[model samples]
Target: QVQSNGTALVAFEKATGKVRWAIGQELASYTSPLVVTMHGQKVLLYFARGGLLAVEPRQGKVLFHFPWRARIEESVNAANPVVVGSRVLLSECYGPGSVLLDIDQQWQPRVIWSDAGKDRWDRSLAAHWCTPIYVDGYLYACSGRETPEADLRCLDYNTGEVQWVQKRTGRCTLLFVDRHLLCLNEFGTLIVLKPNPQKYEEAARYEITDLEYPCWAPPVLSDGILYLRGRGRLVALELIPSRK
Candidate 1:
């Protein structure tokens, strides 16, 4: 297991807690590393403050690095990288917008396209910290700055085109399940909607009045139980289908 500070990555043995390897002396971002298989080998992708670094897990060898960060000094890359097929998708709310990188057979990375060239705030999907979920060749995520300005959007995964946007939804943490989106808003309202790019379709909604703080943590589902976190409490709700 590896842990990251604002600078440097330290890998330790899980059972013995001994240092196995240590690499990376660059500034770090809030995003965690994603272990993925690219080009038939397992590699760790770290979305650091300066860029994205692909590292060999066991040996801590730096494979490649892709620069991605906000031009503003205060902005940081806090979202994890999304891997699709042989490509990697990256987006953040701070700097420019999103970028797509294509990895070839030789493990070299190339920029397929980038939305950061557009007006900073006008990018297709400016995700703050919440990573997006890809469904049927499309991306569904909460896009915008924060709070009232945030919107739930569906965009073409390959083209980065906005297919539809649902406004006034507040900042949301989402989970895609069985072709549906489980959106938990900041106000603790849970909304179930179809993940349709053509239009907005609501299936059900429930407001958890006991929540004391904004539900910013991502909603997690396990064994038919949905778990959520608020200011000081954790909630688990059982998901049972309605009787026919």
Candidate 2:
């Protein structure tokens, strides 16, 4: 849970429901905290309103706090940090487009690449809320704050270089499963794509007629059933065809 001014993260005993540890004064963001292993230790990465805070999960000890949010007052740090080995990627649509950081042996962060001061159209990826799907050595995501300005893009993970862009994709979320990319846009359109770094390759597309606008929730897969939630309804599609 998060508070306005005081401690942000609080750990409670599951069986007894007692407070174990509380730490930090970082304000809340929509992004969820992620636990990753680095340097043979588990660290909790929380993208708060002020920046990224890395903490030791068990004792709530602060490891490193890196400021990486936008300057504007109305902006948000929505995307969850993407971690690949010792490198971490953070992105937002406000001003800081994306930044890749290398975590050293001492847990100190070093900036590898960033598109912070670039033009909006020239930035590699300005993800509004959806986190980029990292595949192979590339990142696939919808970049932009709104539906009209958004585009599906593929970028090189190391250099933050744009490889390809599929325009008019709208603000969409991506899920990779079974060697295919599943994209669910805000307008209730689901697109199946092939993960190709060289070009945009769409395999199939379908419109969920029952789902309305503002389908911001990512698609959920459980027991081979694909579930999509819209503004008013939830629809489940079974991926495996029924036996005759």
Candidate 3:
């Protein structure tokens, strides 16, 4: 959680909300820490304002730390590393774009690749917001570029090659719900599509314009119903028809 003094506190959770341990730093963190288990070992990955820190979960013992100083500007990697197999894919904005690291090694992390063509690598931007969805030897990223138009990019997971570029004139977000690929645009438009291998195809399209300002939050899909909120109003709609 982000503290008031622009510092961060890494707290360990115990039984019944009892504090097991925590680490406070001089700078706050906006990036969310990701916890994962590999080979029966649970580890906590934290990307703070200053740099990246890894710690053990049993007693909060720090494993190792490394500073990312690409530029002297205020920088912190917000794109939580996407872990696949023994590799972790991490992306950053502002001075850093994206980097792939190998986590199976016994020593510190090793960098595999980083893209240099993109100007600003803000993954949360229109063209960069799509989660790096991994598929048959490919990873997909959708974000807005200089023209504020959403662009769907299919990149090679290993080589980072541009497979295809599709200019989508809208905002987009992706999530998997009930075996369906859920996508939403900025203007309260929802599109359910399957992550097709050949191209993008929508399974269902619906609009939820509430006569309010633009939606700033991502929509949530639950059960067979979709829920969205704007301007202190909650709109819930039944997606698939339920059994009579």
- Whole-model lDDT values for every prediction: 0.84, 0.90, 0.59
lDDT of 3 by residue, 108-210 (tens): 7777776435466433222233455666666665555223656655666676556665566364556666555666666677777666656766688877776
User: Tens digit of lDDT per residue, candidate 2, span 63-166?
Assistant: 89988878898888999999999899999888878999999989899999998788888888899899999999899988999889999999999999899999
Query: After superposition on all CA atoms, what RMSD does each candidate show versus the true structure?
Result: 2.9, 1.6, 4.0
Clashes of each: 1, 0, 10
What is the lDDT ranking, best to worst?
Answer: 2, 1, 3
Error of 3 at 17 (Å): 4.0
Candidate 3 stretches with Cα past 4 Å from truth are 1-9, 16-18, 24-26, 66-77, 116-130, 145-149, 211-213
Considering summed lDDT, which 10 consecutive residues are worst modelled in model 2? 1-10
- Better lDDT candidate (2, 3): 2
Residue pairs in steric clash, candidate 1?
6-28
State in Å the error of residue 59, model 2.
0.8
TM-score, predicted candidate 1 vs. hidden true structure? 0.91
